[model samples]
Target: MNFKSILFALTTLVTLSLAIVLNPQITSPSADTKWRAGDTRTVTWDTENVTGGPIPEGMKGTIKLGYLDPKDGPNEHLNWDLGSGFDLNKGSFVVTLPSELETKRTYIIVLMGDSGNASPQFTITAAR
Candidate 1:
């Protein structure tokens, strides 16, 4: 191959390698649903695709696990606990399911930026 072709191939390889090395992309559920109603369901997040800087004061995202109560709000019943939200990088919280929800139910998993739910659209659904 000529010098130009050889140089282009090398550059492409280096670019792809750098992207794989620096960025981590993992999309997995953040809850352990093997427990019963009274049991504590702990959820964890992957810092791979997490933006922000480092741990502790890392990503400015909120990871919530629970079903919101429908009477107050649609799906609001599964909202576990009141004011039980936590900032990302800090750690996970046990979704305190309400008494009304005896069996397992599906809840919304919302991960927002520092600007609350208005951040981007990093939200998903998790089954209890």
Candidate 2:
């Protein structure tokens, strides 16, 4: 191949590699799955895509379980205690569903870090 063609191929490969490496991802709570309040479930993710950056103070990444509703404001954060020394880099977590939700609504599970990766839209059935 000509030098130009070889250069173009190399550039494309590098771009794709970076995209795959830097894209944040969530690995649990599949889209449209239902989560009932008061039940326990595992919230998990992989941060191999974080690349490099300075993580903010008190934030080494976190799983934010909540709704996508704009009216409710900030997506109605679920109160989850990640426990002491919980490593956001560990990529696995067992979580207890908060017992305060009173309505059935679709929710979004997000991996919070330098960037956020959202799970497939899931549902929170009426609190039980």
Pairs of residues clashing in candidate 2: none
Assess each prediction's global lDDT (C-alpha) against the native.
0.42, 0.65
Q: Worst 10-residue stretch by lDDT in candidate 2?
A: 50-59
For residues 44-103, what per-residue lDDT tens digits would candidate 1 score against the true structure?
A: 445545443233454444444455444655443324332334556544544443334444
lDDT of candidate 1 vs native? 0.42
lDDT of 1 at 52: 38
Best by the TM-score measure: 2
Q: Which pairs, if any, clash in model 1?
A: 67-78, 67-79, 68-75, 68-76, 68-77, 69-76, 69-77, 80-96
Error of 2 at 14 (Å): 19
Summarize candidate 2's per-residue lDDT along 59-116 as a digit string, tens digits. 4556666666667765656555433335566676777777876555567776665456
Per-model TM-score, in order, reads 0.38, 0.58
RMSD of each: 10.4, 7.8
